[model samples]
Target: MEPIPNPSSAHPITEERPGEAPIFDWDWTETLAQSWETLLLILSTFWCILLARVVTQKLQLHDSPNLCYAVEFGLVILPCILLITVAVDYSNYIGFVMFSGTLWFLRKNRVLERARTRGQFDLGGNRHMALSVLRALTHLITAINILAIDFGSYYRPYRKSLQFGAKLMDTGIGLFVFTMAMVSRRTHNWSDLRRIAVYSVLPLILLGLARSATVLVLGYGQDIHEYGQHLNAFFTLVFTKFFGALLNILARKDLHLLPLGFGILLIHQFGLSFLGVSDYVMNDDVDRTNFFNANREGLVSLPGFVGLYGLSIYVNRWMVASSLLSYSELVRKLRRLLLVVLLLWSLFVISAYGIGISRMTCNLGYVIWMLAIGSTSLWASFGAIDFVINSVMPWESSPSDEQEKGLVTRGTVAKGGDKSIVSFTISQALNQNGLTFFVVANVLNGAVNKFLRPEDRSNCESVIILLVYMFLGTRMAYELLKRGIRLA
Candidate 1:
């Protein structure tokens, strides 16, 4: 099946009145508190993972796949959706989760101690699974907020801005690009670049074109300032990929990717700050008569994304190496990841004071902000998943031991060894077949908007609709996994 263009940014939720203003024409992005609050919402998901691990282990839920998935969905996925859309006071929810998790750990302190002393409890599970979890959650959250932002129940402060600010929705695109960079790293030769341009880059451009055509033909309401007159997220992906590949060729093999990435980011930052690119892009008064002016947001934002792409490549390289490490080695790698997060966050704090965090323009602060979020998210997932596996498996029969005993084999979340870790399986399915999941999500998002009128719905109705949509989309991903179908 031909994949549907993702409707994340091209949403047509409500009709404009004759003289009514555009829905996405907000003056500035929401405040740091709002963005941080929403960003910290991921902690709820981490809590869910930890809690679900305990519940499943206690009940021996992995004996039945159906029952296991049901528990995971109820505990991990459902609450994540709620936290993103309807729930307020996010810190409270996170705190409650932490308290509950602490109590459970305290009760199992003996088991944990025995496991740790026996050299069994350690952060040595599959790092690849950790990366997959991070990617899946990012995709899932972006999918949820894209539709939910149109609803009355959804927080208005989470909406993307036309000009500037670190809003949740706009941050979604940057996060997506950052993950793409992490996953799509390569040392492209001339032939490889040509092949990538044809096989990889061409399809993304076509996808962008398809979305543009779809919006025009279906008469979906579009905000020109979001990606300017004709571009969309796919185009941004293409630009980032093109530039990243071109730069890789220029850098050759000797130069380290991290320093090269930093240089690109510094140059981009200079252009945005010292050079007038930021002013030109943010200036609404600029006439959209020329092609450059028409797609200024998409064009001007490319360098920052490319810089982000380079940074992710370096990080991903580190992750790939860490995947093969032992427990002690993995701990050192985790510390390195933490340092990366702290450094990026420190840079973001300093840069935002000067250049300001503008996801619209993809400014220096925004790049660091995204890199920080991406790294922090990956670190959290890695630590959490590793903790769950190490803490849970020592008490029960480890999957390896289970196989030796001829017992029911625990399922593996990622490739490599049989850790038999309990995780959000829906995320595994979605990560396994992301293109299919996103296509299904975007098409359904449009269908829901067309039929249900999310903006008019009550809070109760909105939550119900979002829950149903998430269930169906993830269920479809699971079904596709069962069929061994990867649409991309």
Candidate 2:
């Protein structure tokens, strides 16, 4: 063997070469995995908004005026604290710095405006000035926290700061609730409540839809850097859209919907808790992952969150129909049975899609999961609202004289000469129908992403099919929206 060198042995011959090729160094930080932290951070931020809104609505219903003010204050203050803490630990100080700069600019601009408007400038808006000052202080604290989080190599150094920030935020939130309770005792107006409800709920629905879309689009193509950019863009877009919708809703004073929405939310929470117990026993492995990430581990995984959310919504819908609805016992039982069946069916669909199709792709299952979760949530929410409205405010005809005069009663559809009834009926029907279709589209979208990707057990043909389905769904949504607008 030594006498005759084996031709197959390329290693020995290559070793005799003068120099070895240089190995390219790869940085994990440049990859998508590293950006998971950013995604989690953004998710937490969104949760803050959701919590604030939910709490605000709850307080509003109790007629607590001071509580509302407190909630608003807490909403601004608490997040600033948490964000500051996280920023400090993660060395992400930009948010705090930008916030401070914004305050300074606003103050200067206010002075200039006052000077121009009046001969002598007077910043005598003491309350407003105090609030601004508080905001500045919060901003400064947040900036410090950001620096600590982003730059702190060791967690120990920032642990105290983190705890302190959380405590401050919590205390601020508590104060806000207390204030709202005090204020609610003095206010009572049903019409105003209704207006608030409509405005808040509608905008939330739209904002949720937009955010879900942004997540799906951004999660596509498996490019880490692009993914980060998309995540940032999604946050920015969500903030803008939510605030715009909230402003519009506020202008209309449609606050009454808060109670109904809060009720639905409470139902949703109960459903989620039930699902958690069921999932723990039935899907131990998945449960293990979810628990590890959500509880034991600090990392927040999107799929785990969606899966839990979807289960919660499905459960909530059942609860609303069976427990909350004013149906006969038999009807309630039947509805419960049907809900269980649907829940099982949805689970089957998701599992099959995941195992049979999603194994091939990097994050396709997650994308589909998010879409499905969004759709289910919207459907359940709307359905709950419908059920509550019908139960509490059943359609009733007016007295003979009122009816003859062609006046439209609160829940009654007007006849012949009045088009309001027809319009109202059409709008409600279209909205409900549109929501159902939207849920179906979400499920289908998930299926496509799971089974149609090239990495999945499919070729380009799968993608084509998926695209066609999406196109059809989009067209349907557009038509529904048009009908809705006409009715409105």
Clashing pairs in 1: none
Tens-place lDDT digits, model 1, residues 109-226: 6443443444423333333556666777777788888778778777665667545556667777788787776667575588878887987788778777776776775566678777
TM-score per model over all chains = 0.83, 0.21
lDDT, residue 403, candidate 2: 29
Indicate the residue-level lDDT of 221 in model 1. Answer: 67
Worst 10 residues of 1 by lDDT: 21-30
Superpose all Cα atoms of candidate 2 onto the true structure and report the RMSD in Å to 1 decimal: 23.7
What Cα-based lDDT does every candidate model obtain?
0.68, 0.30
Q: Measured by C-alpha RMSD in angstroms, how accurate is candidate 1?
A: 7.5
